[model samples]
Target: MKALWVVGDIHGAYDKVRALLLRAGLIDFGGQWTGGDAHLVFLGDYVDRGPNGVGVIRLIRGLEGQARSAGGQVSALLGNHEVMFLAALVFKQGDPHDRLGFREYWLENGGQPRDADQIEPAELGWLAERPAMLRVGDWLLVHADSMVYLKMGGTIDDVNASVRAVLAHANPDDWGCS
Candidate 1:
């Protein structure tokens, strides 16, 4: 990797992400990430707090593939919003208008829904699979600070797996509330 482009919390700003990639000289007009062979590490928060959450997700997913094909790697980490969205998705199957509180939370925090209908089962499935953090070389990347948890591991995968396992159970606050 020539250079690693660490993107901050996008918060569903699809256009801003697009512009940064383009300005970085990576990716042509085709939405491909290609330049200086930089490894693109999106620091999560790709959804919620913007008008194009769905578009943002699709764009990043697409660019990850494209970047891989172009000899660069795109790693997207999980943020709190991602976790919230997943929680809402899981809750939605049991209740249609579920998470009114969650949606209001997003709105209060500056987010917009992409569509009420025409849901993409694939994207939702993907979100469920995202990890809590990403590790690259000696750097630890997470949507929010995880310094308190790093003592347990030297690798991002290790820490993420541990955190995710904790989040799997109910009453998530019990995990790191100490």
Candidate 2:
């Protein structure tokens, strides 16, 4: 809760994200969590559109544990790009529910199959488990600047629950368009 740092949409740019974190004293050059009791919040879109999406994920996930051990916290929120990536993994391809094909859609949106191929199970679970929204003090945080969160639920908890349910059910209609 103290010294909160929020970052938005890395889009697989590992160098930039890591640089910011290092510069902020959140992590060291070795990518260790150096900010004791400071919180780092990643606003998702960790994959797709660029190389090293998986690397970004690995950094965030690794930092999460390290920071927690050091009395700090790290949180990553789900973005539309993450949604597209997951949908691509699940449905693969073929337009279902009158939307673009999942795999093809992701590719068109700058998805990298290499990232998908190298993604570990823990990373996959971590990505899928990310919240779509959060509140830190007076600041309301969400990955995308969109009104779609409103339709999910009136409350943050409700909206996150709705998202989790959709993901759990793997409904093409619910997650197809991001």
Candidate 3:
């Protein structure tokens, strides 16, 4: 098995991440993960805080495909920021507009409002379907700290089921089994 390169919350700042990766020799001048092609595990929070949230997302999405093509895989776990932006982007019935100020939040955190129109529906849908947690060997990758024990189905499918339940509810207090 190739070495697993687990990354933490980026909070955008694509240029910084790129520079660090380059300095560390993880990626090349062409922006490819050429250092041993390790299994890259992204620990979420790709958007929000810092500039270029959309660029960060696109870069990771592009890397996901490239990593897979290179016989390694990229595990992109869903963070709370992703959930917040997704809720703001998609129509949520009664008060969808109330959640529209995520752009402001992004700005406060050093990000600019992304052109939602430029993002394909299918890609957004794929992002919406991302799992909240990923178990890599004995380690667990999650966005926010768990409030209580989450009763996932003892498998990847089970974890996704639990995450879907939480996302469907859209209540911060009701996340995990407390």
Candidate 4:
């Protein structure tokens, strides 16, 4: 059987992630993919908490391409933090309610200001396209382990489509509801 590797809740710990991947021989010291033909899945929460969220995302995105070229696969699931980050970026002016805006909410929840500032349109589009859940063989991968995904769809395709639709919209309320 092919080997499968899983990582979760990176929280912007780029250095640690790099070190771990190096130690595991998944990447070289130069931070390039070395895990040829290996299946690696990131279970989300790629941003906030630590630092270098942008770096982390960039690394993973690069690795995805490299891994594909090497006959390996690198995939990511969408975590709540990703949603919070996107919400903040898309709705920088804050929500309509007097409570708290997306930016404020993200910051309050361990979001780094630099990460928010460094995000580019491509990165935002990439993050928005991530699926809320994924299935590999018998494994049903989800970020939150919540039943809320059922509301998205009965099938994985449906859920991913629904999430894509939600992300494509500009309304903060739509994002909040998702």
TM-score for each of the candidates: 0.77, 0.93, 0.75, 0.94
Name the runs in model 1 displaced over 4 angstroms: 93-107, 115-119, 146-155, 166-178
Judged by lDDT against the true structure, how good is candidate 2? 0.86
Number of clashes recorded per candidate: 4, 0, 0, 0
Estimate the overall C-alpha local distance difference test score of candidate 4: 0.88
Question: Judged by TM-score relative to the true structure, which candidate is superior, 1 or 4?
Answer: 4
The candidate that achieves the highest lDDT relative to the unseen native structure: 4
Model 4 per-residue lDDT tens digits across residues 30-103: 99999999989998899999889999999999999999999999998898999888888777753463134778
Alpha carbon deviation, residue 174, candidate 3 (Å): 8.4
lDDT of 3 by residue, 1-178 (tens): 6677777788778898788767866678888866556777777777777567677778778777777777767778887677656655543334545344544543455444563445567667666777877787877777666653255556666777777776565553443232
Query: What TM-score quantifies how close candidate 3 is to the native fold?
Result: 0.75
Q: Please tell me which model should have the higher lDDT, number 1 or number 3.
A: 1
Tell me the deviation in Å of residue 150 in model 4. 1.3
* Candidate 4 structure, TM-score to reference: 0.94
> How does residue 111 of candidate 2 score in lDDT?
96
C-alpha local distance difference test of each model:
0.67, 0.86, 0.66, 0.88
Candidates sorted by lDDT, best first: 4, 2, 1, 3
What clash count does candidate 1 reach? 4
Winner by lDDT between candidate 4 and candidate 3: 4
